[model samples]
Target: MCGIVGVVSHQPVNQLLYDALLLLQHRGQDAAGIATNHSSMFAMHKANGLVRDVFRTRNMRTLQGNSGIGHCRYPTAGSSSEEEAQPFYVNAPFGITLAHNGNLTNWEQLKEEMFKNDRRHINTDSDSEVLLNVLAHEIQKATVDISIDAETIFQAVTVLMRRVRGGYAAVAQIAGVGLLAFRDPYGIRPLCLGINETEQGNEYLIASESVALEGMGFRFVRDIAPGETVFIDNDKQLHTRQCADNPSLNPCVFEFVYLARPDSVIDGASVYSTRLKMGEYLAKKIQREGLADDIDVVMPIPDSSRPAAIQLALALGKEYREGFIKNRYIGRTFIMPGQAARKKSVRQKLNAIPDEFKDKVVLLVDDSIVRGTTSREIVQMARDSGAKKVIFASAAPPVIYPNVYGIDMPTRDELIAHGRTVEEVCREITADALVYQDIEALKQAISDVNPELTSFEASCFDGVYITGDVSREYLDKLENERNNPTKAAKPEDAGRSQLNLNLANEG
Candidate 1:
């Protein structure tokens, strides 16, 4: 997954985009980029680093524009290369730049079609670039004039909705025209619209999470509807059209379990409250199984599982302790690009406090266990720290299937629960006992918070792809890509680098 942001304002948006990217840094840490439109000319800069490292004062000064779009990239479709960093720009179709938050399952098919039918050559393996080329090609076909109108844009997006078959929350800048944003038909990813009204005028923002809107002094307007295309004219007029004939609003359940921040709300459901309910539900399960009697202390695996651990401890009448202390400087291990990187970062990211774990029968709570790599390491850390017994509890159900939407898990063999039973998994992780939230109970916990949300994309746990197109062959291809080493780009070939690329000068 990634984070995408678009802003159309009356003033220069360099700082606004920067500040918003900081809030979304958690969504992606592999790479960051921003593209701004100035007088029908595009200036773009991207690099392989966090937002703070990628953009500087000099770089921001060069990115002069009142309207811009930004992206924090997590590698799901392409290799972790600076060349794959987004907001991907195409000079054709009035200099369009696009950034997206989810993966396209039919990317290879679209790439071949673009090359054979549309005569467009994609330079990078990044799916966002392919998506941009698709949009530009469709927009060029639908437009009768130099400037694209709302009807033409909506029609192009509608065609796009049919062609792309995966989850996407995308934002694009149409140079002289304005900003455009759209969501996949399934609404499998999160996208929300917000507005900031000032004496100068009203500024519009589109983000993957509501927290970015709230952090940027923007009022949460509402979620952009499933399969909806939103267009903001240069005059700040907003036009919207439902592009999909039959759209379903099933946001990814993993977003509530771990992906999104607790402060954010998606589809009228609070992530914080959902996690709390998950803790309560898990607590009930612990009581039902009579495991709480042996768990002397409920300890959280710092940060993500704190809410659930707190509630679980309260429900079990056990002491809540912060056993693991995280190093704030380290990036999130879960979102790391490679398995080796993720494994290496886990130890650096967290350390167990001996005083808290010593002589205690600890019950550790985490969001979810994907591959059990980190869980095994964490369990070892607890033992080394002198815990008498270590019991692992997950707020989410076991991830048995590969997530095709945006998460990096692409192979079933990588999952610890793919063929192993609960006892086998417990033994593998070296924990005294392992317990996971029941799938039905998890659904109830999330839905009880907001009855309006009837469905969720829980493909990882339940192995049900909501898009209905993911096949065994497609999954095998994705797994091959994950296992193979990506061809690294040369330093000079890295797109744009820290310096701004002026598309006008290129032409």
Candidate 2:
């Protein structure tokens, strides 16, 4: 849901954070922060906005240091203000600058427990801050100074593991020591390590995704496995520790469905390939479901659906056409946040060409439909373009449930498919008909890739939380809360922001 980076080198590495943030800006756009520790001195800066907007061109090199970490935040349990921003500095016996991606499921309970014991203070309601407190408390528990070496950090982290639950892909800088990185037991999120062969020596870099490493001119090493923590000390020694591991990998299926970048490979699967497979599967599913295949052409919604539409066209032996052109200047709807911004963005985000669909049966393919509004707008555009018939196809199933993880989808009323059938949804969106890829087919398409996974969090479609936060009982509680907003938990303090982020390892 966010991007995080860490670097440990012989020379200054603050620029590494800047470059890495540039690469990961697509992952999160709400806020950006960078922190560094050079010769035991810590410096940090965080603000609400895009990476470029938060850290100006001149300020990129401000936090000069050999050890550093950066975060592009997608708030899980935090506000869209600088107060909740990351790179949290907990000043005490020693300092730690930490940034994180992914949300913790048991945050509310943990915070209450922390208050019960008075072990830590809860501020801003950000899970990242809670995680920082956990690590800081763990460090304080140790007899040896954890700020000096990798072994001490590993030991501290192993102890901290006993206190927390849910997912985390974190990078932290410990003064006079080094940089540390780790992922949760389920390996629900991706983390990659790389090394830069520099004249000074070997500089190690870690990021949430491999693409960031490539962008930073670092050679990809390998993934940092779930339940494993890696520490790089001042001496540049890498120490490893294990907390727990659930070999049955059930990563969030939405990563391939729509969240991750096409060029990025998540859990060893090419995102582009998986998207194409969704198209191929949908093509066959349409045939099985006994739908008319008299479409003159297959059209993509543009950008994300380009590859998928091509695969669909090839499978159906229909011509592929670019029916819509996105306004590159319009930012993503989710990034804008709030309902008014989303509605406004939808109107300005896309444009349709009449020549492409005149008198033809246009089959529309898209990654996923968050709210039915955009699809409705696209349908109107298609009609205005003179398409005789517009058939909608979603590569993933209908989004009936709101995503609390980081996608900014909230409330059942916002989801047009929440209580409506697919047929009814088609009517609502003003489409002739709508066909979604079968859930099983979607699973096969993604799992067919290398390093197979048994299960994944697909709660967005089926309303089932396999891992991070919500349980069936909790889901019922949520439904109750949604029905009675007056009785619901305060939106600002709601822990539901996490969704089921790391549930694959719950068993």
Candidate 3:
């Protein structure tokens, strides 16, 4: 997943784009970039660093513009290379820059089909690159019939939409043409438009979540509906078009579970409350599964589980304790680079507090366990810290299947729980007892809170692909990309990836 922003506003929007990227940092940390049209000159500033790192005081001044688009990336489509960075620009036939969030399930097939059929040479492995190229190709075709105007742009995007089958939300700015944004048929990811209300007029910003808009002093107008295309011109006149017939929301439920920040709102749903309810869901599940009633204390794994642990403690009438203290400088343990060093990483990433652990039978709460590597190490830490017993509970269900979307995760073979039964998984995590929220319970916890959410993308849990069936080729391609991130991240990949690309670049 990635965070994309586009603004067509009254005031010079350098800082607004910069700040929006700050809110979007959680979505992707690899690199950040911005492209703007200032005084009819296309100004571009992209770096393999955080928004702040990329645009320093002197650098930000250079990006001065009234309209622009920016990106922060998490690698779902291509290897983490500078070449794969986003805000991908094509100066030919005029100029265009694009960024995307979510996966294209048919990416490999599309690439293969396009390459074999059209003899199109695809340089970067990133899907966003392919998407931009596809648009460029279509636009190239339309040039014969019409000039690059609003009507031609609309027709080109509309045609391109039909060919793609997957979860996607994207925004871009076409130099001289205007700013364009669109979501896939399923609305697998969230995109909202905010209006900066001022005496001069309303300034429009399109972002992945409402929080970015709110952070930038813009009141959210509403989310761009699923399968919808929005074009906001320099003059601020706006156009909306819907794509495909089957437009059910099916937004990634995992966004609340892990991806989005606590403050961000998706399809009108609260990420913070949803996590709390996931804990509630797990608590009830454990009760039904017949876990012992008298647990000494409920302890969170720190950070991710802290919120859920609070709810779990309340539901079980148990005291909540900070059993583990996270190393703030360290990123989430699961995403720490390589699986080979994951065992050692668990200790360095989190430390157990002896005060809370001594002689206590602690119920350890975590978000979820895909591969049991991290969980086992954490469980060992609690035991080593002197807990008499460690009862493990996850806020979400067992992640048996792999996430075909952007999240970096183990494969079906690597998932400890994929083939094993609940009892089997219980034995693997080595918990005295274990429990997880069921699919039905998860729906009960979150659905009504957001009426705008037409469908929930629980693809990871239910193995249902909302956009379409994911081809085996795409899965293989993703695994290959992960195993070997290209040495030089493609411009689109670097631009969209969230991994702090400057570090990789420096390395």
Q: Rank the candidates by TM-score, best first.
A: 1, 2, 3
Clashing residue pairs, candidate 1? Answer: none
* Model 2: lowest-lDDT 10 consecutive positions: 496-505
Q: State which candidate has the highest lDDT.
A: 1
Q: Is candidate 1 or candidate 3 better by TM-score?
A: 1
lDDT of 2: 0.77
Higher-scoring candidate on lDDT, 2 or 3: 2
- TM-score winner: 1
CA deviation > 4 Å runs, candidate 3:
112-120, 143-147, 341-344, 451-454, 471-507
Residue 90 lDDT in candidate 3: 68
Evaluated against the true structure, the overall lDDT of model 3 is 0.76
- Model 3: ten consecutive residues of lowest lDDT: 497-506
Give the per-residue lDDT of model 2 (tens digit) for 128-179: 8888878877777663743345556667787666666655789988787677
lDDT of 3 by residue, 233-266 (tens): 7678888877556677777877877778878778
